[model samples]
Target: MTAMEANTDEGVIDAHHHVWDLSVRDQEWITGPEVAPLRRDFLLADLKPEARASGVTATVLVQTIDIPEETPEFLAVAADSDLVAGVVGWTDLTSPDVTRALAALRERPGGEYLVGIRHQVQGESDPRWLVRPDVLRGLAAVAEAGLVYDLVVRPHQLAAAHEAARLLPRLTFVLDHAGKPPIASGELRPWADAVRLLASLPNTVCKLSGMVTEADRDRWSVEDLRPYADTVLDAFGPRRLMFGSDWPVCRLAATYAEVIDAARELTAALQPAERREVFTRTALRTYGMTFTGSQAPQEAPCA
Candidate 1:
């Protein structure tokens, strides 16, 4: 629809991205004057065009604003949209009725679309934000519900994420944005250390999404993101890693094709099978999607 092609080169699965509409939903967090670019509504129909251009057959719709009312709303949206294969909705994990909340969210028509839970842990000031007893209990509930936990943390909070990985060995955790490392500053040591530590846990996975936005917004090269991307691959290997476009957020840093190109170039040295997992298979497994649908796979030109 937008003249963009869905990147089919590597069997890609966009592990993370957000879909919101101010009219039907409350995305107040993005209403601030400074965040205007993200204020408008972005529903599934709005996304399908770009998603198709990017060769994204399936996607996991993550929550934008933390609202209990929004989780079920998203599940309803997912129920109607074929492209949105999974949802990583929000829940009051800290609430005493956390399990009940999850149950209610799962019982909706599109409740089957919910594959994971995520809290905006990066917004917290506490370095050890995820280790509190209440939070740990919530994570355990997520595990018990058979859902994955997505860790959206900043670099300082990654140490806490690593700690959470060690503490909750049964919970499946995915590190969003490669820990949101400082690619703009070109700093990698501390983030690399934390990512490696988290990956050492068998249940943890890393997402190769959102790095472009972490680099200089107006000016950045694929080379600038290479070290961080390479490090994530080395730490998690292909099976424990997945691809994501971060979409409209990525629009601030690069086009969908540009970001996809960068990732393909970064992982070019890997065998086809490894690239396949990072691009598609792992996401299918993690988000519980069946890739046996009738849509034929499209091929992409090499960058």
Candidate 2:
């Protein structure tokens, strides 16, 4: 049966979402009139019920800033929550002591929930930032620690992401938001080609998240997102694609339930097993996540 025909009984693993508190640290990125809605604190407590009602039994809490203190604090939050199964936190990729820093993070309380590391490479001025020697060394150390690396890149920076993934064959590289395609303008040239190139790498995966924010936030339709979503589905197939909410962030364009519904509509053409891959299996493997709820699927080794 097609995904649309499948029962909604299947559990979901929201591979990407974030939580932050302004009282602890200012989210300097949350500025300007367009982002005013995000200036307030987004705590896990605010997300739990909404997530659970949407069939999300587990979620990967992603990093929002470059702060050294945020990851440990997120780990602590994960330790206390039933919903957060994994964390993709941040650290300075260029720091000379990256390996030691990773080790120290692993030793912290709730550290075992640390599944991956992400840097705001999209914010870097250098176009080829990921391939830089120091950054590459840090990525290698991340691989050595048996962790995945999440790529949060702009469309223009995808080539560098491709090269970085090519350079690190052993590391599992997850492309967040399908490289943030140009859905707002309906442009699909280099973005589609670049995503195809990155997906050609055996070590990479792509998230079916953040597309709503990338589109016309005020009036986006599933049709507006189909081209980019179809491109990634064709390139990476179901096994390499996973679902992510990009929540609070997705709130810029859609509510959590609306985003989930849109994803279901987009993938309605796929078979039931393929749907499960996007909604469940891929995240289970990609992050090596361990879920605590009764609906959680059995753990599987990372592919």
Name the top lDDT candidate.
2
Best candidate according to TM-score: 2
> For residue 112, what is the lDDT in candidate 2?
85
lDDT of 1: 0.80
TM-score (all chains, Cα) for each model: 0.91, 0.93
Worst 10 residues of 2 by lDDT: 1-10
Q: For model 2, state the Cα shift of residue 133 in Å.
A: 0.5
Q: Residue 91 lDDT in model 1?
A: 95
- lDDT of candidate 1 at residue 17, scale 0 to 100: 79
List model 2 lDDT by residue over 41-74, tens digit each. Answer: 8999999899887787778899999989999999
lDDT of 1 by residue, 188-246 (tens): 88888888888888989989999998998888998999999999999999988898888
Candidate 1 lDDT at 177 equals 87
**What is the Cα root-mean-square deviation between model 1 and the actual structure?**
3.9
